[model samples]
Target: MASVTYDRTSCVYPGAERPAVDELDLQVEDGEFLVLVGPSGCGKSTSLRMLAGLEDVTEGRILIGDRDVTGVPPKDRDIAMVFQNYALYPHMTVADNMGFALKIAGLNKSEISSRVHEAATLLDLEPYLDRKPKALSGGQRQRVAMGRAIVRQPQVFCMDEPLSNLDAKLRVQTRTQIAQLQRRLGVTTVYVTHDQVEAMTMGDRVCVLKDGLLMQVGKPRELYDRPSNVFVAGFIGSPAMNLFTLPVVDGGVAFGDVVHPVARDVLGRAGNSSVVLGVRPEDLELAEHGPAVEVDVVEELGADAYVYGRTKLGDGEHQITARVDGRRPPGKGEVLHVAPRAGHVHLFDVGTGERLGG
Candidate 1:
């Protein structure tokens, strides 16, 4: 097992005006499952490639454990990469595919067979050892790819959106399997995905990036509960947080007719007449008196539902979403009053879009 480090590492493609991956300093603790997540073109993939030795570091260095491997070739990095496409050889059987790296390293047949069987058993692919890649299901094929990586017993694992190609149900199932496997193997892994849910559920810690800059890094709950900025506040959650720029009055921001009280120091740090108020849908309730939300649509999710509506706060009408009992949602075009639950509201600076206080 080994830890991975990005010591101000950067990657700038040729003719690019800006670096694809900025000087990102991050550390993946030994035997930790760290996920790199962001929207498309956010440099999550580039960061993973840099650590895998596939992309060159335009500046600074990368480390695997204590070894500086910035200039090292991909093969010499002692890392195993599981790609999105399930890069399995069509002509080879499952056993052969799993042991191919060992063969390249000149390990004898007996040892290679042992390792292949062990990995196949762990992945429940032992029954299809003699089957070719074409004969396996998509999930099975991905397992074979995982098995290939596992057989090598490398110092670190780099998985680049390995679940992108699977069906939604299979994706969920496979993700659970992979998380369990990683815990059992205890290998330091850096997984890249654009899916926040994947990053939230799988990683020991998640690193969120935007436009190649690190946004926030934290445990799933920490990032969800206390995002460092407005971008992360809106990005990490499923329904996303409802944010509005409201006039600061009486040490609080206006929620229409109501004054959503905030700490004086919290609003003081922002130093602005307007502060951004953020409340998650789940954090809101259908109250008797608060802000008036004109109901637009209600999304039913069996046990609960989300109310997507609009409200006029200050300048113009703004969108608001609130979670409510699925069986008792207000009708369309109806007006409903909602209030944010105490201690659940998030405040941010209007100008910088940064979080205002703790």
Candidate 2:
């Protein structure tokens, strides 16, 4: 296994005014599973392609285990890539497809057969060795693609949205399997996906990018608990954090009649009349008396429910969401009082959108 590094690497398409991937300086330790995650057109895919040698690095360099590989050919980079579409040959049997790379590399028939059988056994595809791609299920076909990579034993693995084609249930199951498989193989991997949930669940360290710039890179819980800015604060969670630019009043920010207290330093950083307050849906609780919100819709998910509502705050109507007990959700058009749990609120500077000390 090998560590990978992008030292101020950038990719700018010809004639484009701005770079697709800005100066990205990231390091992945040996045997680490690093995930690049962001929204569409966020340059996550371009970053992955640059590492795989599919795209040119317009500036800086890429290193694989201390070797400068910015200009290296894809085949010479000693990396295996798994594409989203499976990319299995339709006419070849599972065994043949898995061993095709070895065959092209001049491995003898006997050696290729041995390696193919070994990978098939590990992937539980022994029974489907002779079956063609058309005969296998989506999950099984994905396993075949993985087997193709495993037999090569490359120093680095690059997977680009490898689970996008599967159904939801299969995607979840396969993600678990892939995570377990990566740990077992211990190969340095770089995975790209637009799904934050996938990045949170599978990556050893997750990197968030926006408009080709690296926003934050940390353990899943770190990014969730302490986002660096308003963009990240609003992007990482499932329900997303509810943010309001409320007027500062009495050493706190006001949400209707409710005043959520802030640290003195945090208040000092807000040099304006208002500060942006953030509260996750799960961090909000139904209160006896707080801001009154008109319930618009209730989404029940068995274990929990999400209450979507609208409330008048600071002379304008704003939408809010709160998580409550699924079995006892409030009905539509009903008004309920909700407040942020103590010590669970996030404060940001209104002018810069950066997180304030708390």
Candidate 3:
């Protein structure tokens, strides 16, 4: 319903030396689902709080559609937020809790009832309208919280880790439901979570942040394929991208006795500077003859198996990790040859952590 914009917005916690969020600029399109993702203490939550008017903006402006709402009170901003904890009125019935805001805003009884029923039906909670929060399951309680926001039909919807309390199976189920609901309602939504998988699966666009600074913003596949830096590369992938700080010698890099060929274009940028090589576990496959990897453990995960091991490269260092595919995985203490898939390697400048070659 509305496009949200943060124009150089920033926030500093009282008495803190550094700002919690620094000059953060972002744009969320109308009816777009934008996700903010980062590790703990990465300021993702602070940025969301600022947008919700729960935190003071020390600089810049936040705009909803074309209106500057930096100085506006939260209640007047036409935005509804669903918190991680189900902040429901324990004493009120489900229907009353959903319609309480409308009642407070002086909507007529008929209108309130209609809106409540509409939201309840959409969330499949019509059967439990008279039930209290104490009687509902955790997932049902979360739905009630969502029902409260849906009835308002606000310009923007903000969710702060709204599914964190649910069990893993319930979380996955609710995730699909929420995504479908957002698309059906076509409401502009901003969601904040630390889970990369959640951000990747649910967002129309994802903003990756660290230390209060925006790192990269893009569609899920784009970030996965072409992360701007080492942090983004490692953080966005499951099992994380394996990063090796290796020396570039001649036109190739030495991984023990095996001197894998590097693209001339990639090597030209090295120029005696230390380079970082990043390879996803999926990218490195078992080779007939390649760099030797010292196997540590093998895990059989039904559909796939992970070969955990250390590399016999350079000083014969040991690092623990899992290799996919159990059928042909190397046994413990066995040395297996590994090679990166063509065009699947990621190279970065060690000093800057900037991507050099795809």
Candidate 4:
């Protein structure tokens, strides 16, 4: 296994004023599973492609372990990749497909056979070793692709949206399998996906990217609790974070009829400027005495209910969402009092979108 490092790396397509990735510096520890996650056009995939040598590196260096591989060909980099599609050879049997690379590298027949069998056993594909790709299910074909990579035992594994082709249920199942397999094999891995849920559940640490910039890289909960900017806050959460601009005056922030005290520094930054307040759906609660909201819709999600509404905070209208027990929820057109959990609130500069609480 190897640690992968990108040092001030950048990639630019011809004629584009902005690079697809800019001064991207990150490190993946040996045997660690790191995930790159973000929205479409956020450069998550571009960063991965750059690491995989599929895209040209316009600046900086990439290192695997202690070796600088900035100019190395992808095939010589000792890395195995799993693509979004299964990318299996339809004409070859499962075993042959898995062992083809070994055969090309001139490994003896016995050694190639042994490695293929070991990988097949690990992936539970031994039973279908003779089956061709046409006969296998999508999940099974994906396993074959993984098995092919496993047999190589490369220094790093780069997977680009490997679960995207599977059905939702299969995707979840395969997700668990892949995580467990990586742990067992102890191979350093870099996984790329747009799904936050997958990144949170599978990665040891998630690297969030946007607009060619690195937003934040941390354990899942850290990013959720302390996002560096408004983009990270809004993009990382389910139902997303509710954000609204509230002017700072009298050393407090006003939301509807409620006024929340702020720190002196936070208040100073606001100085007549508007600050954005962010509250997660789960962080907002139904309160008898809080900001009044007119519920427009309610979604029951078995264990919880999410109320979507609009509230008047000072002279501006802000959309609000609150998560409450699903057993009972306020109806449409009903006025409800919603309180954001104290100390769980996120404050950001309205103009720059940077977090304001130091």
- What TM-score does candidate 1 get on C-alpha atoms? 0.98
Predicted candidate 3 versus true structure: per-residue lDDT over 60-163, tens digit per residue = 99999999999999988999889999799999999999999899899999999999999999999999999999999999999999999999999999999999
Q: Write down the lDDT of every candidate, Cα atoms only.
A: 0.92, 0.92, 0.88, 0.89
Q: How many backbone clashes are present in model 3?
A: 3
RMSD after Cα superposition, model 3: 1.7
Each model's TM-score? 0.98, 0.96, 0.95, 0.96
Q: Rank the candidates by lDDT, best first.
A: 1, 2, 4, 3
Q: Candidate 2 has what TM-score?
A: 0.96
Candidate 4 lDDT over 1-358, as tens digits, reads: 7999999999989999898889999999999999999988888888888777888899999999999988999888999889898789899999999998899889999999999999999999999999999999999999999999999889999999999999999999999999999999999999999999999999999999998899999999899899988999998888989988887767677766677778887767753467888989999888777778999999999889999999887557778888988999888999999878888889888778888872
Candidate 1: which stretches are off by over 4 Å?
none
| lDDT (tens digit, per residue) of candidate 1 on 1-358 | 8899999988999999988999999999999999999999999999999988889899989999999999999989999999999889999999999999999999999999999999999999999999999999999999999999999999999999999999999999999999999999999999999999999999999999998899999999999999999999999988989988889899687887888888888988886899888999999988888888999998889889888999988779998999999888778899999988989999888888899963
Of the pair 2 and 3, which is ahead by TM-score? 2
For residue 258, give model 1's deviation from the true position in Å: 0.3
Q: Which prediction has the highest TM-score against the true structure? A: 1
**TM-score winner, 1 or 2:** 1
Give the Cα error of residue 342 in candidate 1, in Å: 1.1
Better of 3 and 4 by lDDT: 4
How many clashes would you count in candidate 1? 0
Clashes of each: 0, 0, 3, 1
lDDT of 3: 0.88
